[model samples]
Target: MKPSNGSTVSQQSALSTPSGPSSASASAPLAEDDPEPRPAVAALPRHVFSENEAEPEEGRTGDTPTLVFGVPASDEPGFREELLLPTYEALRRAFPDHRIEWREMSKFDLILAVVKREVDLYVVSSGFFAYLTHGAGSSWLATRKIPQASDPEHAVGGLVVARAADDRYATIADLRTARAAAASSQSFPSWTAVLGEIANVTSYPEHFLGKPRFTGDSGLSVVERVLRKETDVGFLRTCEYETLVARGLVHPQALKVVGERTSEALACRTSTELYPDLVLAARPDLSDSVRRRAAAAVFLIPESASGYAWTVANDFRSVRRLVARFGSAPSEHAEPSAALDRYKYALVISVLLLGGAILYSVSVSGVVARRTKELVAVIDEKTTLEQTARVSRERLSQLERAGIVSELSSMIAHELRQPVAGLVNYADGLALYLSGKQDPVVEEATREIARQAERVSSIVERVRAYAKGKSDVRQPSDLCVVAKRAFTTFRSGADLTGVRVSGEFLPEAPVSGDPLELELLVVNCLKNALHAAKSSPDGHGEIRIRVSDDASGEKWCLEVEDNGPRIDDAKFAELSHPVTSEKFEGLGLGLSISRVIAERHAARLLFRRAGERGLVVTLLIAKRPVEAEDASHGTGGMNGMDGTLAAPKAVPASHYGADPSRNVLSDE
Candidate 1:
């Protein structure tokens, strides 16, 4: 599910940034409602959608392989600057439960970076992609050129220009003598599709005005130079052009629109026929699954209106056609390498095959004979390791049993006695004061004793299952009952100190997880969510939890999403890979242990990402029936597939759902 439009960043803020400094005065002030720009996201977590519901539009009838992408820098100045960044950011923000990473490098370096077994994806300009696939690029990608993720034929190219002017160069012919610049001559829609064609008509100055001038230094530089009149023109895709115009870099009338092209109505304009821009290309040798995932990511981008939506998914044929026609644009890849590769395989093969036949056979036989002994050693070692694992499992099981028992006992004491103790202390102290001091002081003390007694009772009531160390529990429970119970159980004195638990749930939606454990999970998730949100740039951020299922079968996903700073891909990977931080407190055990519990129920654990901000942690539990056990709410009449189960619809107010807003906070 998507967050509220405000929390997610309104299109207005994104569309209205002033490019030049002076425009601030003439430009409207920041929204009155928004004294300071709202933090990217709110601090509260909203689960308007429950974990046991289907995602808004993800109809998962089948499975797709995972795909990887390799890109250069993060967002940059202009046209070419952040093309992949937002796409990457949006992907992370929207689909927080997938695997994606950026291998950071200049787009120009992708020519050498993409090999049969190298990166699974390369997000370069369409023109740059054309150069690689011209020949063996097929060997680099596959037998033929293909669209990165989408179907190529459906993809369109874009044209970036200074906004159109009433009195301006009317056509490419008119601008034939104009000095136009671009982020790169090799940029997809910019130079390759737009200005490069213009170059054929324009007379080349011996220098960029006087020296070798190129806008490819950065996308924004081109726009900047054009605005400064250093270059007469600049090019960008419609989306990018909109971004610049929004940012106030160039006015709509600052430059002339020499051309405009479109693939659909109400679509962003382009200078040339639209061709695939950022593609999810596979390393010539990626597995089928990887390729599929890569494609899905691209296709799904545009699903949510506010999601990082792509216009279309393209196929290989049309993409190849464009690559063939455009050929290679001017690029820096032609430069010679400073380092040389050495080949030692030939020498080794010659020595092994020719000179050492007889001698090598004798040596090989001896080595093989010795290896038979080594195999024995390896098998023995493996057996020992297995044995150790068994012993460790036993010990760990004992420890878990002990921990649970101990924790339960502590909870009981803590719940039943703490408030009682407080009451006793207050009463005793007051009795002494009343006898020896005054009536008013005794009355005040008596009130405190009553308050303490009530507080203790509240704890005892919520922790019934925890105190008993049993899974048994009865329920006529509604969503509010469960939430309030959990909240009271883990009550913290300060609202800000603990997590703000705020998502809504459908009470009528039947769910099967153990109510006690489920409550525990929610509380734990709330605790973590609050901590994580507070640690983020959007101090008080929003966490969205949603549940739904479609063609992929029933799934219950709890997403603790935050647009806080994103963890580095490397660190994120480590956490996901069953990593252990020996002395790490709070975060380490929580995620690792929670993951174990989720998997036991045939659920998945995932961490979502944002652009260098916040983390979205999700527990995706399949709704299929469990073969081993029945669901907890057996009478809810939920149908089961395998051992997992799903109700006809979420229990009213008990089944959870959520979406977030910008600055403003709402309970429902």
Candidate 2:
């Protein structure tokens, strides 16, 4: 076996058991000498084998398998060797025909030997054995029972020690700034266990104990360093100090245990929780029969002088928890530095991916905002075009309707002109016959008949000129005179049993329009009002004609109001066009013709709701100045009329015969 630092591997033959009478004395001479004297053995258990022990049933043969036992070399001379001597002697006695070899190596190398299948069985720390069981599929065989331990499973723990003379360091807190020493970083009880305990107290265990110095492969060196003041505190396996004191190597009062714990089943002074001690485990590939035989041989070995025996340990959970708390278990595959390098690469890639995602999101947001803005502008343009198209359609329809009405009017006037002339001639002859008779009522009736016949002739001429598209002769006209005359005619012609008519007129409200056309406009308004009022559900209705000038004296308004069922906005809008009439005998041209006449005079025809149950029709025309009467006389008359300007005929107010209480006619 070669020696490296304090670790060495020694291969020994199990058949080379000592022939001496005492096993302790026999095992003492097997240890290799060192510069420092080794501690004397305390006591040795009785040897497990006798000279007449049973041999294996199968005799020694060339095909006999050799059992390789792996053991970790310790820094302390002869410590592990002497402890395992009896088991070697017992195995040699049990399998006399088979060969047994002892192979010693460092703890790390021994674990590798087991993993590589080079060693059939091995001795390992409880914590490392748990790691092997999980990571390497190693199987448990037995656990070493510690001397004076109440429970074999609770035999191992770590110790924190300070110089007894140093009063400044007594508890674990006192060692926070103290330099720490240990047997080896790989030693579980001396190093890992203590670190795990300190980890429980502080998040940074490295800062808690400062930095630990690993002396050698033995806890004895750790104790020596503490005595020399090279380290303020020393970490050791449980009972290591007591074992040294028993060997008379160190004084009992030389050092003190920091934060020592007392346990009912544990006799050792420990600074951490107890776990199972050394375990004997078999490689998974080993034969079951061979494994059972090896375990039986381990159980046969008597307890050592230092109180070491083997028994099955059902639980190693405490050891497993300790290893897990310290982060990772010992592995032969990778080092810590290599794993850290992989982590660095992963972090850089993650950051790059995150930055790219943010940039992508911002770009997408900008694109969506621009798209939304463009869509809104398109929508607004579409709405404006739609409105323009609708207005154009309405104007085209009105022109078509007007053209049709014009043709119809021309035909009707042509057909009626001769008949109207014949009626006028007949009325004239009758008036001549009745003039001298002087029956007052008959005379007045005859005059009315002539007047009406002449009115019909004038209306036909106006319609014929409109059909010919000839401009009418505009003249200075009083809207009040036109309104009063139209209202008087409407009252006389229409049934008025339950109907009332009234007029409110601005006496000289003036506007520039053809007098005949103005009269036609007022007459159409009164006709519509009377029809609306008579349609009322109560069969009682009122009509009022109002002519007034605006405050600015710029426009004259002729308003016809009636207490009738009102029309909704949609129905009223239809009134401006030649829509189907609501009345049974109506031709639906009254309002439309009125609108055309008002437009000819550059005026507006409007209709509105009056209160909750009425309709009001208004004609707004530009006011005429007094001087415009002479200005109009200078212009010639209409196309078919003579070149003379006919003065507006005057009608007596008494001819209206309006009832003072009901049919009121006011000249305001």
lDDT by candidate, in order shown: 0.48, 0.70
True lDDT of residue 487, candidate 2: 68
Q: Write the per-residue lDDT of candidate 1 for residues 145-243, one digit (tens) a residue.
A: 122213334344546454343245555555544666766545566555563445445554122222324654544456556555565666665455544
How do the residues 360-398 of candidate 2 rate in per-residue lDDT, one tens digit apiece? 999999999999999999999999999788767866776
TM-score of each: 0.33, 0.43
Q: Least lDDT summed over 10 consecutive residues: which range in candidate 1?
A: 40-49
Question: What lDDT would candidate 1 get against the real structure?
Answer: 0.48
Candidate 2, poorest ten consecutive residues by summed lDDT: 44-53
Which candidate comes out best when scored by TM-score?
Answer: 2
TM-score between model 2 and native: 0.43
